[model samples]
Target: MRRGDEFAAAIRRGNRAGRPTLVAHLQVREDVAEPPLVGFVVSRAVGGAVVRNRVKRRLRHLMRDRLHRLPRGSLLVVRANPPAASARSEHLAAELDVALDRLLRRRGPDHQARTDGRV
Candidate 1:
């Protein structure tokens, strides 16, 4: 999941949800047996190397609690927006929660149906 290809695939094929501070792309992979894979993208638009690393650290910490909530084998890429550079951790966490909620709800019914082995 650390590779650029993985991030590109998620961005291209996954469902997306966004907030002012962050954007998330998620794709469910049926063949994966491992826990959810999460990646962070903090562009230069967000800040310098120090700032980007800080943002990434904050995101990673926030996502730890949320990993279990994601579908198993899901690929998730969270990109920090420019606004995120000045955003507080709480604000980032709130936005992440909202985005994840929306994304999960959008896929919920279909996922449940598939897991139940029904069309």
Candidate 2:
């Protein structure tokens, strides 16, 4: 959701705080002081413009749905692979869930406590 220079900087940092996956490459940074934002990178290597846009659209939707599970005040960059350019919505959704859970796990025991309503 971040735009302009700030978004570009986050991608350049490329310090993936969470686990990376085959469906997407995630880079999470907590250096920012603002609310959490997300960026998508679907290169030409993945497909034509239409396909790339489609991938971005799907990723955005998945991110919106999973935002609450993510940590606050961080930046997440989701880079799409070539296969993801044409992936179906259901398949992409499943992959997004897996990648998101992996990333969320990096937040450690705090999240577990939150899940159990003990935090």
- Best prediction by lDDT: 1
Model 2 agreement with the true structure over 12-100: per-residue lDDT tens digits: 65444322322333444544444567788778888898888877888888778776655555566777777786678787777777776
**Candidate 1 has which clashing residue pairs, if any?**
none
Q: How many Å off is the CA of 118 in candidate 2?
A: 15
**What CA RMSD would candidate 1 show?**
3.5
Per-model lDDT:
0.86, 0.63
What lDDT score goes with residue 29 in model 1?
76
- Poorest 10 consecutive residues by lDDT, candidate 2: 17-26
Each model's backbone clash number: 0, 1
Those runs of model 1 whose alpha carbons end farther than 4 Å from true positions after fitting are: 110-119
Q: Estimated TM-score per prediction?
A: 0.89, 0.72
Residue 94, candidate 2: alpha-carbon lDDT: 79
List, residue by residue over 1-116, the lDDT tens digit for candidate 1: 69888888889999999999999999877777667789999999999999999999999999988877787778899999999999998999999999988888888675754422
